[model samples]
Target chain A: MIEALQFEFMRNAVFAGLLASILCGIIGSFVVVNRLIFLAGGIAHAAYGGIGIAFFFGIPYIYGTIGVSLAAAFIMTAVTIKAKNRQDTFIGVLWAVGMAMGVILIDLTPGYHVDLMSYLFGSILAVPSADIRWMAGLGAVTLVLTILFYRDILAISYDAEFARLRGVPVNLLYFIYIALVAVSIVFIIRVVGLILVIALMTIPPYIAEKYVRSLMMMMVLSVLLSVVFNMTGLWVSYHMDLTSGATIIMVAATGFFISLGVDQVISFSRKRKTQRSSRKMLKTKKDAL
Target chain B: MTQVSPVIQVQDVSFSYNREPTLTNLTFEVPEREFLAIIGPNGGGKSTLIKLILGLLEPNHGRILVKGRSPRKMSKIFGYVPQDVNVNIQFPIAVMDVILMGRLRHRGHFGINKQDRQRVMELMTMTGIPGLENRKIRDLSAGQRERVFIARALAADPDILILDEPTASVDTAGKTELYALLKDLNETKTIIVVSHDLMIVSSYVKSVACVNQGIHYHPKNEITETMLQMGYHCPVELIAHGQPHRILKTHGDF
Candidate 1:
């Protein structure tokens, strides 16, 4: 197990997992806060259209998926913003349409013999150095952009109308957020594939949310938790000879439940302590009387 | 008392959604540091007028100016609190974190610094919720939640504060406390509140703008049945001391 780190594929997988964890944790904080989990899921699954387009047009998958996913994300953002009350219905419809389009287009690609499971369940063991580089570049860009627009994003995510009143360019920020999610989703798909991407993007942050006091803190904790989950899951998959994506999701789920249990136990102990203290005070008062 | 320039000016502004008119030929002005209450029935376009002034919705005709400039240009000068604060409480955000959001325009794209934290603390203190700075927003009561939003608005230190039904969901005591807080704030800034509770507005506001489709301005003490009828398009009775209020007959159309 310790010797696995020397292998090139293992090194690439570990690097990619760590990088992907940071990106997912940061963006997932926003996605969970803004209730964009469904939208992010939609965007992720929708990137398959880009994959199909790439196969058909014989272009690189990354370029095709990024471009197509960005366009879809923009459209989703526009529709949701413009028609505020009716956003869910529109997003749901788009989600289905995007998935259907991808499946159909992929079927039409001439003489294409690509393994679908690799794209669906992920192939972390097959991660190449080039993909790691792409993930690193995208991760760095996301970090810089998030740090720069931290305030605006925080404002909009919490209260959009208030942000608009403060002279923040709400619409522009909205579009930028969706675009960032698009980029994040593209890389996230590379790690967990479109099928399990939502869990990877949401679960760690969801668990981290309970303990953090600020959004930045939540992001930090989430990234750390995500890395732990991803790395451990990767290690488990290597030893057990199981699927990498499923293993990561299982680890995240375990973390979420453990956090919940810890919270419950802490609350219960606090309650018991308070009750004990109150009884002691009562006994002391009775003796004094 | 020295009078400052009007912070908000509306002239012949008309708005509609889906070709259905909501506000028609509405005109009003909110002088600087003036506490104005806009009261009307449901679907009477009070919120619409507020939105138009806030530049959330564009009017089909006429103009609105904030700080002597268009709403588009003077966005930063205004702070708004909407009626419904029903946010997903499960959302992972802290109280001070929410208040710090109001400093976005000042901070621009970068994250909040030490000064931002100090300002948020100050606003929380001003709103009398200093203890809530570290609390999760979802754990707060309705009144506390309202104060958090108020603190967020005050964080910007804007020239104007616009609130839609700020006291609607809170208890009676909370309503009284909130109105008193607003009254104190109005001494230094313009406040435009949209509310249906006329008694509270009459007690706290300096002036009132009654709107159904258009707007009719009146001094707080001088509000009458005729004016209420005209503005609300319904019969109104000023029940003195709650001794079975009598409904005044509706006036004839002009």
Candidate 2:
């Protein structure tokens, strides 16, 4: 892997993966804790429409995709806020529509001959230095914004009503947060593709949530886990000639299951020990009687 | 005596959802430092009234004033404990962190100050759960969770503390203790609670306002027959407590 990094594209790929990991770690923690997995999934899928819009219009991919996805995010947020029960139906519709529109637009594009597989299943190895720089810039902005508004975000995420009472601009922050999620999803699509974006966004954070005691700690631990998974997946995929995106997701999923099993085992043993001690105390009382 | 303005005033307020009226022609006033409990049957606009007061919702045809200002303007002066915190219990957050969120209003660009931390700790100590500050919120029992929420609300040090169904999840002993705590807090802060527990309301509240489609403000802790018949499910005469056999046969059996 060290020797592989000597190549420019390989270095760019590594950089891309690291940047994607940072984003997934931070935004994904919020998605998991806020239970916005469905919303994030909807945004990820809907972003495909933006990709299609870019290709169809012969415009810059990031600009088109980010705009469309943000619009879709705002619409979905509004719908979810208005009719929470019906949000699933609307989100599902938007997801399918966005993907369908992307496919149709790509099909109609004049003389378009790009590998659709890359957009659908990720092409991290093909990442250019320019895209890597873009990812880094976006990552920096996300980190700065998160730090600047940590208190308000924490208050809102923990309890919106209480946050509102505290004079936190809950709705405005919500819109901005979702827009950031949309942008993050767009970049993450370059690494894991739209279909697998949700997995990458949720798995590491879900695993970290059990061990960490605060949102910031969860994000830090999640970032480390994501980086490890991404690096390992890249190396393993290179050796096995497998898909890098799916391999990374599978690594994270494996971690998730392992954590769940370990958690259950610890809780089960703790329960049994307590039960045994209580029963022993009852027997001692009986003996005394 | 100085003529201080009322802490809250609702003037002919009517709210509707989807063009259907939820609350109509509601008018009320909460004076300073009063313990007022709003009680009614489910879907009787009690929650809506609270929402209106919190500025979470607007009245379609009337106005609501908190401290002689609009609800939104006076939002910071009100500390609220929602009926449902609606938190993802599995989320990674400590009890101390949750309580300190109440001090977000006091946060500067530098983040929470030592005074904010001390206030949170003071509230925790007052609520009798100082030992549980470091624990995760998910680990707390229902009663403990309520106390944490109450402590969080008090951490804001607002002039009015509004609680929605504060005792809903509490056990009987916990409910008594919670009311006692509220009674103590009422000495300095105006207390407004929306509760379904009539027994608790009768015991602790200085005033009772029954909200249904309209508003009925009882200046004293008195549940009149007329008020019960107007909005509640059961008539006051039929609710004979402590007898296991005296259940209402129908919605309006009496």
Candidate 3:
């Protein structure tokens, strides 16, 4: 693993992974807390349309993906916000259509034979320095926005109508948040592929949430956990010549299941402790009587 | 019954969903320091009334005046609690964080200062959850969580407190304690609660408005069984008293 750092691509991959961890920590917390996993998963898949548009138009994949992702994000936002009970179908449709569009657009792109799997199943080992810069810039914006609107975002996430009643711009903040989620998917797609982005975004936060009492702490823990996963995954994948994205996601999934088992063990002990305390209280009461 | 300074005035307001009428030509006034209970059956527009007052939904016609200003304009001064908190049950938010949200209105930024923390603690004490500030909201019982939400609403220190089905998740004893808390709170601020627990609510609220597409406003807290039946536009079969036992005799038609 240390020897691999001599390669420029490996160094770039490391930077990309670190940035991805921070982005996932902040935005993924909101996504998980707001129960937007399905919507976010939809956005991750639907970002394929942006890739298609970029390739077909002979533009940079980042710009095309951002454009299409934002459009899909806003459309999904409008649908979910307005169509109270029927948003699932809309998201499903968009998710499928986006993937299909990307496939067809790539098919028609005239000169794209190799390296396609990189986008679908990530090529973290081949991350370019330019993409790393892009990730850093987007990560900074997400951090600043989250810090500035921390209170309003927390209010909106906890209870949107109550936030609206308290004069928080719920809808506007929601749109901006969704937009950021869409844009951030571009960087995540670079690190983990669209197929595995949701796992990386959700797993760390899920584990962090179980241990933390506050969203801020949850975010901090998610970033730390994600970094550990990414580092471990990168090291193992490098040693074994495995797919970096898949390796990372496997590490996170393992962490998730382990956390579940830990929770069960902890809860069992807590139950026993409570029972013992209750018995002690009863005995003391009897002696006093 | 005691007509005094009005804090919220709904004048000839009407609202519709998909061109279907929800509230029609509703006119009412919530006086300062009054506890108003909005009771009606399902699909009777109780939630919609609260929405209109909160400026979430604008009326198709007429207007809502909150403290002589439009509801939207004075939204900062209105504290609202919905039927449910509408958050994921496992959301990682501490009780202090939940209540601290009440102090975020019209604030420039997000840091919780000493005074904000003090205010949150004060509210927790006022609502009877003083020691649970550090507990995760999801870990709390239904009754304690309700108190946290109510304390959150009070944390804003708004002039009006509005709650929709605040006792739905709470038990009977919890419901009574909640009403008593609201009754205590009513001495300083106006409160509008949309509730289906009419019997207990009528005992605490100073005025009752039975909304069913339109509204039947009662001025006194003493809402008789017959008046409630008329307001429901049907027979009041289920009587929610000490225990929710049906006072109606068995039907002979069966």
Find the candidate with the highest lDDT and give its number.
2
iRMS values in order, in angstroms?
1.9, 1.0, 1.5
Could you report the DockQ of all the candidates, in the order they appear? 0.59, 0.74, 0.63
Share of the reference A-B contacts seen in candidate 2: 0.84
Worst 10 residues of 3 chain B by lDDT: B245-254
For model 2, the local distance difference test gives 0.85
Residue-wise lDDT of candidate 1 within A1-289, one digit each (tens)? 5799899988989998999998888989989888898889878877877887888888988898898889888888888877878877777777777778777878888787567898898888888888899889978987997888787777788777777877777788778778888988887787888888899988988888888767888899999999999999998999999999889989989998999999999999999999999999999999999
| Angstrom error at residue A259, model 2 | 1.5
Q: Candidate 2 residues B79-185, lDDT tens each?
A: 88888754567778999899988888663334688888888888888877878878998888877888899998888888899999988788888788788988988
Pairs clashing in candidate 2? none
Ranking by DockQ: 2, 3, 1
Which of the predicted structures, 2 or 3, would earn the higher TM-score when compared with the native? Answer: 2
| lDDT of candidate 2 at residue A185, scale 0 to 100 | 92
> Which digits, one per residue and each the tens of the lDDT, describe model 3 over residues B16-133?
9887899999998888898887877788788998999988899999999988999988887877887776456788889998888888853654456889998888888877788998
Q: Estimate, for each residue in A177-263, the C-alpha lDDT of model 3 and write its tens digit.
A: 999899888889888898899999999998999899888899999999999999999998998989999999999999999999999
Number of clashes in model 1? 1
Clashing pairs in 1: A148-B109
lDDT of 3 at B42: 82
The best candidate by TM-score is 2
lDDT of each: 0.81, 0.85, 0.84
Model 2, C-alpha of A101: deviation from truth (Å)? 1.8
